[model samples]
Target: MDMKKYEVGESILFDIGQKILEAHWQDLLANTSLRFEKVLDVVTVHQQKQGIQNVRPKNLAPKAQQAYFQTGAGQTQHLITDFFTDSTKIYQQLKALDSILVRNLGPEQIIWPFSNRPQDLLADEPSVPPNEAAQLGVRLVLSDELLTQLFTTETAKQYPSFAAFKNAIYLHLAQNIISNLDILVYFFGAAPIAMPEASGVKRSAIQAKRFLNCNMFQDFDSYLLSLRKAASEPQPKLLQAPLFLRPQKGDLDYRQGVQYLDLQVLDIQPNVADGVFDYQVQFLKLFLLFNVVHTTDPEKLTTAAQRFYQVANEDPTQPSQARPRVTAYLQEMREFATKFFPKTDYQTALDKMTQVVANETQAPTAQLALEFAQSGLFQFGQQLAAKNQRILTGEPYQLRGYTDKSLEIQQFIGSAIELGLNYRFLDGTGEFLQLRSQQQSAIINARITAKNPLILQAILADQQAMNNLLGFAQVAVPKGFVATDLTVAKSLFHAEFEKSGVVIAPQNGPKTAQQVFTTPIDEHTFTTSFLEALDYDDTVVVKAFIPGSVYDFYILDQRILAILEQVPVNVVGDGQSDIESLIDQKNDDDRRGRLGQRPLVTIPKTAATAAFLAQHQQNYQTIPDRGEQVFLSAIADLAAGGDSFDVYEEVDQSYQKLVLRIAQTLNMQQGHVAMIIPNIYAPYQPQPNSAIVTDVAAAVSIIPYSFPFAGNQRKLSQVIIQSLFSNSAKERADD
Candidate 1:
């Protein structure tokens, strides 16, 4: 488990079963009992035996016009349940099924499809009795009376009476089903066609909606009461519900809760090749986990279901058609998978699904749809089945570990290890490490002993002193005056404002910029912020507010190692959600986790956030129009939740030269320089510039230079270590 050696797109294998229909060319295979076997943790289909009795005409007919499928007398129809240990095994089983079908019924009789839509030939079939059709569709042959008797006997063992246990079971199932019905429908809804007059309903409904109605029951007792009422009432609404979890001899049972979920909503399409893809399996697991952790009122379930249906029914080939909420949910699921299956290639599957949702033409679904459109469905299925068969016996998948840290640190560590550099922990906590080469060993957290301690101390103790040192050396620095009191600070702010907009910051403190004000000088606001800065430090500095993006460059002696551009935290409104909701959504991103665990820090709901909102004449309840951008904070400090995008490659030569001159003037071996530039790519240099310098020891946070929010990441720590080795070698040569 060295996480450094782990691959990015790897995931663990799991054993799960997915339902699919058995077909020979265009004909369904009926009454087939599939047997499974396990050998060394790998499960496969051992045998497929035909049932002793054939499906009667009464059993094959549809109970209602909206039923999933309808068949004539003696028509063979069966659903295949494929059990697999992983995606590769699922592919193998699908290939085996294809071969078996082709061998038994000839190539012309072998049809591979993913949807469960009924055939057009069965449209004129006779109507079967509701009870008989229910039994046949789910293969639940046991009578309700017999099932009740058995379940009651089992329930009496665990409770005072069978009634109590049955109620509890119904309650559990009802809550889970009601809360998750919307997502379930979205995932499995495939039937989109229906006869209007026969069902007294116009258009088609999702497969899940074909049978189950949300208006049926309020709780466990009500569900049981409804069943009794349905048995006596002719043409009861409950008779047409899609899901069947009643007392039965099949997947579901009252005594056993839900042993299996029979989803009739899944549509059979040729593009899926096999029954489903690897991402579908991953999504199902995450979807179940999410349902278990979150709960919603049953009243809101219908609205959620309708929203999901609208999105699901849209042409997935268009990215713009995809709802933002659904896309956000998918991203959250991917993050959840990374936590649960850290050693698996689950992220790769999720990434592919994301691309599919985003309407990438290269995705499997879109690509297959194109092939189907170009060469017809049957030909596309045949070619895809052949291709799938070829890949069935490929190499077995190996799981690898996943790292949760920012990508830059991972790359730096990987590169360091590749270079054969030996590193040892400098502290027991493992925060500090000493990296060693033959010529020198560099301390990661303490890289400033090479510079004079007194000079570094003087500069860090006062911002004005540092500005004067840089200014005396003819290097550009912001013109500013210090005030020891609020009255003096206000006077200085007004004076600065007369010249231009003023910026107010604590003169002597670790995080002076955290509460800094970058607004036009006003008596009330300036006095307020000035007083706030005094709470942290004794003095405050008032200067002109520079308008540009802040850039931070790391310097080892005189050489620039890396540079980053600071981007303030902001949110884009979609018009549908309010500002508070948008902020919540942005904070929900995995990259914005607490501490330095992720690249970007989480946006905090603080007084500053409210103040920023008030300054813009807006509040948390305000609904910004679509495409509107709102800033959440004034200062662009990563510590205060601002984002940093790398600008190392885009740094102009003049900026680089300015950084080197600042480093040389400071007389430090290693340090950092912060500057403001109009354009990162532009060649213009700062004049009477607003910038600050931090000698290596005083620089508390240089990690931002390496792990920026956007642009190409730089291996800054590795660069620093390499510079140490180079400096040591040069010193030896001079000696």
Candidate 2:
């Protein structure tokens, strides 16, 4: 395993280095307080020693800069912890190897070392002292280009052979350290010696022991070694999710970018059977000798661990053969761990995952509520509870059959409890929520509407009856009619299109109390025939296609609460990547979550999306100019990866007044009204032909306003609370 005895090609070794670099970035993003400053300090010292000059550092974003210097001045003492212990020759040799890397690779090859300087760059300043340099760490940036330049023919020739070049760069990188060393050693030669003092992991090991409550171990490496050994044994038990608590000395890590850190499950690739590491690492599943919980609550830890084991036990014996099942088990464990962790922030990451999963697995209303929970509304409710001397009783629990596979109903109950209201299940079936305060009460049905005794009468009205009501109210809605026969629907659609110069389309589903003309026209069959493919039997309402952006306005009583502008799923061209590549990159965003999990939905490639692209004379292969926005779907639905913006402040007051007028005309004291407006922010102008009301829901979601994809955050929760508790006398006076 020694350096001289190992053999690896130069290019392969360079590839290994690149993988290590990629791993470093992942680790940096996952656990920002992993002592990356040590890496930066080592890089700076070597660069200075090599006399590399006339270069300037890239001005990293403020948050990124904080990540590099998170450890602060005190933690850097480990750099020279045992300066006297090392033989001068060993130190000089390590330094020399690192210096050679800098000299040969040069500034162009090392991105983090030095970016291009401006013309007015000042002369070189005196170097900081070794200790001071460790405190003021530099950025640790490594990219694909950096490694490519290292393996160039000219650079490789600088050494005696390719082996010499490989050894130098790998050894240099080892001193600075990169994540997932097993991958590195699998491709590169012998693993570099563990310079504990230089890496500061020796000190970190002691702190980690106490933080993880594993004081019996000498350091982090020993603890990991113990876990690794357990993982290999027969009848091994799954361990509780572990934590990587950085030695922050009671303060939060600045690298977190936020005031607190959520319980993070770092995806650091585990060590292979033969690879060795002398420091802490991360993995999804853990196998341990004894019960060890990574949180303040042991009960929660045990529960999550037991759940993980249940899945594992149910899984087919060989996880390697049951890859999907194993992935499911791991995800199950992660969800429990992430959700159960005590929250110091407004909403934990699990909420985002829950919404994403709900969108994939549950009803539309449940998805809307869970997504809305990710906003400050949930936190606001909790804060309100704290203020009112009410304690949050428990975590979200699911209601079977009604909100099955989703936490929306549980969220509503939680919010009600937090608001100091008493709640009772109307019946054993748990289909309704009866939330009451001393002053007032309301009974909410499964879909969020206030339950009314006459609701059955309203529900019995079909599409034509509803349209007649709207017509009587004189609302300017899309013009079309319902037809039972496919041929008649198509003929009517064609006639409407010819008259208005717009296509009339049938909706893809059974009509709801409120339906919108948001779905694109199915040009394939020119009717609601797409639904027939899904075996749908109900008649659909055909409406003239209204061309413009979709705007949703939520109104309560006389006040316009919030307006949301929904944008179709689209990607802006980056000049380099084709449409397909750009989509892949966008989907790769961490916020996109695993498919079926989300802060944002993962964009899907469907036949509809393809058809939409074909209509625009574009396909996945097309590479548009930079900044061009290419729409993938004509439908602006969030569930389909469309984006929403909080446009309450941006909407013109005249438009707000107009929406309110329509709401009043419909006798909608509380409802969501959607309109087709060319520009939501433009001054309102009378365009009876162009602007039309598309949809109206008596009960609508608060998600788009609270957890929008873009634009300013709005507090729809507050609006709801106010509406619910507003004084009857004052409301009457205002009206």
Q: Give all candidates' CA lDDT scores.
A: 0.48, 0.41
Over 613-632, each residue of candidate 2 has an lDDT whose tens digit, in order, gives 88789998999899999988
Task: For each candidate in turn, give its C-alpha RMSD to the true structure in angstroms.
Answer: 23.5, 24.7
- Using lDDT as the measure, the top candidate is 1
Q: TM-score of model 2 relative to the true fold? A: 0.42
Report the Cα lDDT for residue 236, model 1: 86
Please list the residue runs of candidate 1 whose C-alpha ends up more than 4 Å from where it truly belongs after superposition: 1-416, 446-454, 485-491, 494-500, 508-513, 521-524, 680-682, 685-700
lDDT of 1: 0.48
Give the total clashing residue pairs for model 2: 0
